[model samples]
Target: MDAEYQSFIKTLRAGHKPEFPADAKSIEYARLLDAQDKLSFLRANFNIPTRSPLRKRALDGTVPGAVKQLDISNGTKHVKGDAKEDAPSIYFVGNSLGAQPKCVRQYLNAQLETWASIGVNGHFTSLDNSPLTAWQDMAADCAQQSLDLVGAASASEVIYMNTLTVNLHLMMASFYRPTERRHKIIAEWKPFPSDSYAIASQLQWHGLSPSTSLVEIHPDPETMYISTEHILSVIDEHADSTALLLLPGIQYYTGQLFNIPLITSHARARGITVGWDLAHAVGNAELFLHAWDVDFAVWCTYKYLNAGPGAIAGAFVHERHHHHGHHHHSTPDPEKGVDVVGYLPRLAGWYGADKTTRFNMDKVFRPAEGAHGWQMSNPSVVDLACVRAALAVFGQTDMRALRDKAVVLTGYLEWLLMGLLKDNFGEPAFRIITPGNPLERGSHLSLLLRPGLLDRVSETLAAGGVVVDVRKPDVIRVAPVPMYCRFEDVWGFIEVLKTALEEAR
Candidate 1:
């Protein structure tokens, strides 16, 4: 391992004193943490799934007798060694797919009712008894709610739009302006596949080869964590030729939270546009995009935000980019001819046209002010409703409170896992690849397990009702979301993991 990473781990181990007694694997410590937890009540806001008897039977390799002979009461059948009907599974996959909120159904039902009774009028007119306004304004309302989450200076700087990859393409269309002298794009060596593909294709669109036009920064071979120094060094090395620097706010695999403000300032100083893929960072980290002066950003709502699958994503364009002096027109500008000062090239659509003259059907395209000017079509009202429903739960508490609880919750999980390793194997059976500093990472922890053991460990965990996600090769990622997960859940996961490891061995 690199000297920097070794020192980091040593400092992490020294700084983290166990909050519970040495016998932290016990349930008593778990319950004590739960009792003192201020956010415990929030867990009731979600609908956690219970293990079904059939699932348990399958896990245990048992076959149920004739289904017709089963006893049924209150819509639940009696089965031997059945799990309690209301018991929630120990969910640790919030980083991948957050647990559904109970209010989603309520919000969807409202939209359905409005659509049924109001018909086409629902597009522009609000139903009398409904909480939602006209369907046309749904995206705008959701965008307003997301402003604080992303720390935008104004609602106009943020917009609710298409999926992550789609929005990424849109942002790149506007921001990735390559020049002869500065045509290179700086990015991580292992970005999410979609991001890599988009960047590569963008280079190809400009008739440039990926090998020469792209500069990817790799982590030290020994320590998987990429150091901030290394990232800045690459930026400085290619400052003269780099046109754009695109990276994730929180690395998807390692759960490392990059220094956004620091990197943005450095890139902007070099006269390079910077963009962030905040898919994992949106609700997971506290961001200040406007204050940091990021050129642009895009994110998906489905992961930490708890919006349903394929939920509508969001985008950010700095307010300085909203200059209206360069509106597209049929006639050339009388004063400056065709070249307008401070104009950004956008793939214009009618939805992005000025609201006042939008329906007038003029040939000239007068773009709407700010981020809304980037919209191509009306967003899905159903998707906006789902996002609004999820944001409502977030409205109950501020990000600071949630993040504060997260540090303790995740630290507790890490402590218990370390204790398990020491007591059971007396050596490192697995290594935590995620950065140990609470300030440097989010809620998820990525464990790099022994070779060929990840699948067996994950399967054993699933059989025991502990749900986590396994990345390819040898990593298992677990996240204890602060909003819904409890200290007891972390403790229970560790105990189950110990047993799972033993079974795998």
Candidate 2:
């Protein structure tokens, strides 16, 4: 880690977060920071949507980085200042959907070609000069590619399969085995709706009442900050009765990155299984699932991962959870037809079977070792291709580099936002709900605006070529994605927000 980042980490650990540098007040400073950024070259790999394309409801054969001219008068000459609508947008919504990677089109086409050319043979055949591996190995290939992103000890610990909610359901099926004494699940106050639904549904499936089984840890009333100490205290309170401790690695609404290691260790020490929903944190922040001794974790690939929306999600199962076998009867049972093989119980299917024996057509189940065993079906090759292309972009650089830049980029954003603390009439416009500490958050900032300003503010920002996520009831999420967003984008968003505030008022 850079010394500055190391210091920031220490400050975060010590609970002594200081404010961002006050000097980043000018657009020139943002440009200077951009010029000095080592990872700024990474922006070219992604297809950042421009203002015109973003507003377009129908596809016009237009793609980012491609010039699409229409409705030209007199020799199709370009007009100065009027071309602002065609300029690249300050897309600050990677928290919702990341900018597309340029390689996705090629990867998808290659997969489509393989399907068209070889049909069934494409599953096992590795084509020449191809960007993707065989379809059969696509999930593993993506998992191997993601080892560093999620910090797994081995590729086997990570598996790319269904969407995040499905993975969570599968993980709970295996890890959320509640006994009479420990039927409760400890969760943060607010989880993404999918997670809350999954957790609650799982409890219902297990013949347990959600009211009695679900224990939620509420955050601070003022800041919406869920501290590590508070989480640990909640775990302590329900230690014996809690079967699972599930929390988001980063809160989706607040963008508050949790202390995963500390929280995981604390819960696991009390005989509670730890699971993290890294939907926001996986690509936005650093993770160490294996090292943290996390029992399991789940994440989607769309946010900060540059994969298309509803892209294949991934999960991590500790090596200890990967059971090649536990205990099995040598003889086939007369009732069951095949010899029973003992392993971690999951909602298994043919895809989870070992590749060697997967097509045996026998009734016997031989689960694949590691997280892959949790898979219920063969993944979509199309989804895998998109994931592969996205991961390929990440393969060019390590998480440390991305995170290092994000820390600075987000700090610059905060520093600038701080200058706009109040309007010209001297009233506070909005309050940032995300933590100020770099180590305690990710690339995005969540601003809780004053009442009645969200819709108008959102409209003004859209008109000004600044794309952001406005979570209704007055919050705007601006995420300057480290992979494609520039420091200038951050500066431009603040400038647009300032204007929007003026107009909204």
Candidate 3:
């Protein structure tokens, strides 16, 4: 851990105190402080960006590389800026929508000019790097980073591609085989709506009604997360009839990091095809899609990946699934065990019209090998460019180090929130719905607003320039993203939240 980060952790633990909102009673500040201290120590090791200019200056005053520069605006009303500010007002509410990355625009601009000047010729003539070489050369690097983030063994099993759900539907088409005995699918209810619709329709296409065809695991009414044990039990009970297990790597609303390896391993052991929607966890946490033996997985790159909005997403299919009997290779390379070229996807395009013999084009669709087999269409160059730029930065750092820092930072934030609750609302007033253990969650904390005070507290925080996201009726989510969120930001957010609570009252 960096000394500066260590110091920040110590300060957050011992120095900052949670302030109680007026009109609240029966809270214990001291006990909360002790818990906060322990959490601060845990997260005191990563580079978290601070939005406060004053804090940044203070943090950088002594340490040389204590801070990082991001072009974010600081406005109380909109939380928008071109430069970091003191206590940035513009909270990133739309992480589910997209997170702004400083490098993506520049990358996209460069690609735009290439496309404009050379037209199709840019495929071979682009400056610095040729367009044809782009996917071939860059694919390995991009795939490697993505694989690392997702916990894959080799880059061979992963490939960058189209949007998230698109890849999901594609992988489903190939992997999902419904029979009379095991015709049902299992997934979370209301899973991003699109996933729900897709799965429902998949069952419907097989002449199965959603009411009986899909098993949705709903959260307990009072809690925001589902239990892994409960899910496993459900699978076991339905193992005979459950044909597939489709789950999100992380729950979008609660920010819960599911026990993916455990669940996937269990389901695979029972002959169930397992796939994951990693929209929230792709870059936010550590994963092992290959080692976990996940039959297939897909994710969008815009969120934690720092890729700009609409950036192309990627998917992974275990290499084991591509060899031996399935998707037999043509003149398969005997040396590499599996033909690398054979695994490369040849989607619906003129290029696949049997460059050697046009008559072969008459054959029915045969899926590509490995992860590339999941691709349905070519990706946008601009989107690929943006993702490449963002991933370039990620390549420079250690993902494990980042994950360690994130665990601590998010834990610290939760500790601080707990302190605020203890000092202000007291027991029975409000409770945290996010898991208490850091291992069960990610970088965000879901604070369930007390009954009757949800709107007021959230509104007060927003008005006072405290940037936390609200999830409808009650929950307030605060994410101290490790890559860009700072320790002081955690402290400052809690401080301002106290004031906001007071003003709300």
- Which has the greatest lDDT? 2
List of clashing residue pairs for candidate 2 = none
- TM-scores of all predicted structures: 0.89, 0.92, 0.76
For candidate 3, the TM-score is 0.76
- Which has the greatest TM-score? 2
Candidate 1 ranges beyond 4 A from true positions: 1-20, 53-81, 329-342
Candidate 1 lDDT, 1-505, residue by residue in tens? 1342234334443545334456557788777777766678888777665555325532432223222432333455444554454356788888888878878877888899988988888888877766677887787778788777999988889988889999899888888867787889999988999999999999999888789999998987666788899999999999998888999998988888899999999989998889999998888888899999999999998888999899999999999888767445434332221224535667778878777777798777777778888888977889988998999888888776677667777888888888878777555678888888777788899998888788889888887778898999999999999889998999889978988788777
lDDT of 1: 0.81
lDDT of 2 by residue, 1-505 (tens): 2455456434544445535455566778678777777788898888788887787775445575745544434454332334776689998998899999989989998999999999999999999989999999999999999988999999999999999999999889888888788889998888999889998999999899889999999999999998889888999999988889999998999999999999999888998889999999988888888899999999999998978999999999998777545354454332222234567667889998888888897587778888988877978999999999999999999998888778777877887787788435577889999998778999899999999999999999999999889899999998998888998888888888889998998
Give model 1's TM-score versus the native structure.
0.89
Backbone clashes, candidate 1: 0
lDDT of 1 at 177: 69
Cα RMSD to native, each candidate?
A: 6.5, 4.5, 8.7
Determine which window of 10 residues in candidate 1 has minimal summed lDDT: 58-67
Ten-residue region with minimum lDDT total, candidate 2:
331-340
